[model samples]
Target: MAQGQSDPSCRRSPPPGGRSLRQRYSGDHLQRILLVRGLLKLLLVVAVLAGATAAGWQPATAWWAARNRPKFDTLAAEQGDVIEVINSTGTIEPVQSVQVGAFVSGPIVGLHADFNGEVKEGDLLAEIDPRTYRAVVARDKAALAARRAELERGAARLQQARREEDRSNALAERNVASISESDLDQAHFTRVGMEAEIVMAEAAIEQAEANLDTSEANLGYTKILAPVAGIIIDRKVELGQTLAAQFQTPELFVIAPDMRREMRIFASVDEADIGQIRLAQESGKSVQFSVDAYPGEVFEGKIAQIRLASTTTQNVVTYPVVLSTPNPELKLLPGMTAEISFQVDRRDGVIKVPNAALRFYPVRDHVREADRVILDGTALEADDQARGESPSASAKAEAEGERKRRHVWVVEADGLLRGIPVTSGIGDHRATEIVSGDVEPGQRLVVGVAPKDD
Candidate 1:
């Protein structure tokens, strides 16, 4: 046999299943190629799905946006009262108050007045210990009596000296008396000395009388009296309480004269509001106020005084504005807090705009390009910085001249925003007075974008 040819017996035969080993291996390799093709098909399907999803996203978002378009918040311009006011909290006090105190140092022996008690002028409010004062008065009286007795004795002595001097003169004239010339001179000197002593005694009596009067006055002071007819709002002294008035008068009571008739609210108004307060006073506008004690009860007052003195606290200056209100009911008490409103100006049936409308800022895209210049304050700043420019001096001057001119937004029928210039007057927290503007009553003014709901 040649090397290239094999014997018939050496060649292998097919298996009983009629499949050779080469054929079986060929089948397995074909199955693997088919499985690889199936995996490629799966990957292609996944890629197609991803592409489809990406392509549909924008349309889905558009449909949702069309369905839930942004609605704007709006307010209507109308005719109403535009009231400008300055509000503040103030402490209520009596229009006039008197402080009663002890002039003499002594223990409080009796209390004749009570807190919140009504009193008249000269009514005894309290009493100090009178025993010591009475003793002083008695001593002063005795001293005065002694001075009078001394004065009487001195007068009698002066009369006797005068008579002695007369006797000496008679003896000298008759030239038959035992008295010598030196004795006559001594008598005259004694009479003169007696007269001087009598004068001194009279002065001592007057001094003693003054001392007695002072003692009596002090005794009277022991009984504390109300200086004016009023209600006792406070009492500082209790029975048996000692008061030391050596340095200063010890405050014993506080009386408010005719507090029921009128109560004053000392409101600290900002200096910025002082001018308006003066204007309100000149205009005869009544101030509206209420107290915590009567939350629902409103009280009316007039500007009584606007003090020139200003109080400074933390770089803020405030002037004291005194508001006088009639409190015939006596419901407003001292130290009660009052919420007051000083109406600076009031205009009725005037075109007014909502404050929100004035403060609203519109989206840049929502506004027209020409009106986008006044879209929002922050945007305006950014726009200015980008342009490297600022408002011109003439523009600023024009804006200042147009004191009430401001820019506001309105929605056209096409659902886009357009800014229109408006002239405003006095305003309050809720609305501003429209002096002149293209806007009319009942016209809807865009405030802001309404919130989207889920």
Candidate 2:
């Protein structure tokens, strides 16, 4: 071979120890495809991871929340007294009150009684000006004395006329006197006239005596007296006070009779509770009350009367009830406000439960699946529920339709919730008596859930 020249067959069609261009190009394209496929697989893996995270987050959170549930508060059933009471506000006052008034128009001159002073029947309370009445009485007495004198004089004249008439008649009959028959008739007529004059004088005397009596009564009216034995609660008339009694009698004083011995409480009971109060009154049930003035003390009273007259205020009707209480210590005063309680029913040594337990309502998850229907407000037949036709039964009252079926929650041994049905009879604000149920004393019942920590 010549220099820088090679034979055609021995020459390298492709460079020695190097691949062909086609093969290099093919290898580069294959590497590119493999990189793209690897990138696609990484993207698919990321999408799958995102989907799994999104799908698992909610369930995981729910499981954690269920694990960390709220704590519950509980109360135990106990044996105690359950009293149903009717509360009312009342005012203390006297049992009977009387108003003393002025009968005659006069100026008050003397005050014999003061406020809160005790007075007996016919006791002097005040005195009015008696000068004008005294003068009228004297005038009437003088007129009566003059009438009596006139009556005596007329009687003497009548007797004289009668004697003259007798003498004239005798003389005429004997025919010895020189008098005419006409003179004898005149004497008889004079006697008759004198007798009429005597009668007129006697009538005048009686009239004067009546006038004197009227004047004396007027004089006695000047001294004011008490008609009943009581304490003077109010003294309206003071010294030098003028009272005019022309149209209506002006009230001078107000008296409360027997106030120290007894006091009455006037309470307004709601119409809704009137039936219960009436029944209690018929049974002679006692009432308990407390006053703001005497905070720690309680006063007992009995129902005295229930007035038929009802008073309506703001579209609410109420009846007045009068309660009588002894006030020997005089601690209760008039116008004091009393907080009264009327016990309609009472249960002693009965299985009682807290009212909070009955009022508690739980979420669906806390209760069993079967009982969850109860919380859903699914109506069940009263008869079937009371007869225990279903596996779960309600109280006996549910059968009679007198009461509604109710359930209370109790914690089971496996940390699950169980329901108990009970019939309630009498109840107070805090507790209630269980009439019929599977409850017993010292049984713990769930009342409410405690708040979660912040």
Candidate 3:
């Protein structure tokens, strides 16, 4: 190209080396601008991220705190008494059970009573066939009569003999008869022999009379009668059934006296709990119970006796406790299974709290410190220390020992929680008694706090 005058293509184009330099410079500028823009974008993103982190910190912390803070339900701790210990269990049984048995052996001719039948004293229960006994009695009577006749004949003979002996003696004395004949008559002693025979016959008659009385008495025994007024719970004999009394008297009936008057409940207390049972013949203290037959219903009774006899089964020993209850309505029957609660102890108008309240623990240091402050305000006896000691140790020793105070959480007006110490008393598995504590009737106490996601 000419100087200051150039062809179109040549003007548009650069020198080869020059064009390469321009291309390189434009690429470098574009790269530098892109890098600078990228850096500014990175700085803007960093700033935005920093602002977001700053904005979220307080809220996230607050949410975490809210989740971890314990919440509570207010309860009152009132003064009350409680039974520290008691435990037992057993079965229901009748105080007295009578087995009615036959006195004499014979075929049961008739049955007048059966199971569950009410009866009175002297009431006829069963009868045996009296034919054989009657025959025996008749035979004895006939024997007695024969003996009486024999006695009378002997007496007449004795009278005749005596007269003869007297006549012989008189003849001998007067010399009207031969002396040898009088001596032979005296030797005979006819009256004395007759008198001995009559005495023997009278004894035989008396024996016969006694035998007859025995037979009659046996005959009376054939008619079975109730010895006491009661209800018949069981009858084993049937009409025409033969009973043998050769070895043992056959049981024919079982009776219970006056079901409407009273009933006994038998409960089996485990050996571990038996020590708590107190037996009394006349304890005014009452008990309540229910049977599966009568759901949701309650029955009342009084402690009657604690049986000393212990029964062991399958390596477990138990004692039977008996309670007497009036069955005036005859609602309770024999052999009923009962679930019973013996009023071992009771307390009223006492301060009580949910068991969980005493088991609560805090997470935050400030909250824990606040709780300590509240607990210190309420001074309570250190009974828990005593509990930790040996049971055999004296009460005074336990009282004087150092105790670790128990703590619970209470919500303050500022929505913060604080720990409060309390003295615990008699407690069931569900609730505990507050013997002494700063907690009021309506102040809420925390049980547990929910965990938060970090």
Each candidate structure's TM-score, on Cα atoms with residue i matched to residue i, is 0.81, 0.78, 0.73
* Of 1 and 2, the candidate ranking higher by lDDT: 1
- Between 1 and 2, whose TM-score is larger? 1
Per-residue lDDT for 244-332 in model 3, tens only? 87779999998888778888888887777655456222335578788776887889887777788999999999877888888877777
lDDT of 1 by residue, 1-454 (tens): 9998989998778897888756767878878878999999999999999999899999998888766766789999989899899999999999888999888989998899999999999998999998888999999999999999999999999999999999889988878557787999899999999999999999999999999999999999999999999999998888999989898889999999998788899999998779999999998999999988888788999999999999999999999999999988889899999999999899999999998998887778888777876656556656766996667999778766655767778887656788988988989999999888798999899888988777
- Consecutive 10-residue window with the lowest summed lDDT within model 3: 373-382
lDDT of 3 at 279: 29
Segments in model 1 whose C-alpha atoms lie over 4 Å from true places: 1-65, 176-179, 376-403
Return whichever of 2 and 3 wins on lDDT.
2
Q: Evaluate residue 72 in candidate 2 and report its C-alpha lDDT on the 0 to 100 scale.
A: 77
- Which is the better candidate, 1 or 3, if ranked by lDDT? 1
- For TM-score, the strongest prediction is 1
Which lDDT tens digits does candidate 2 get at residues 338-432?
99999787889999899998888888787767677777663454555677654425544455445534677888654557788888787899988
Clashing pairs in 1: none
TM-score of 2: 0.78
Name the lDDT value of residue 194 in candidate 3. Answer: 92
What is the RMSD of candidate 2? 7.9
Which residue pairs clash in candidate 2? none
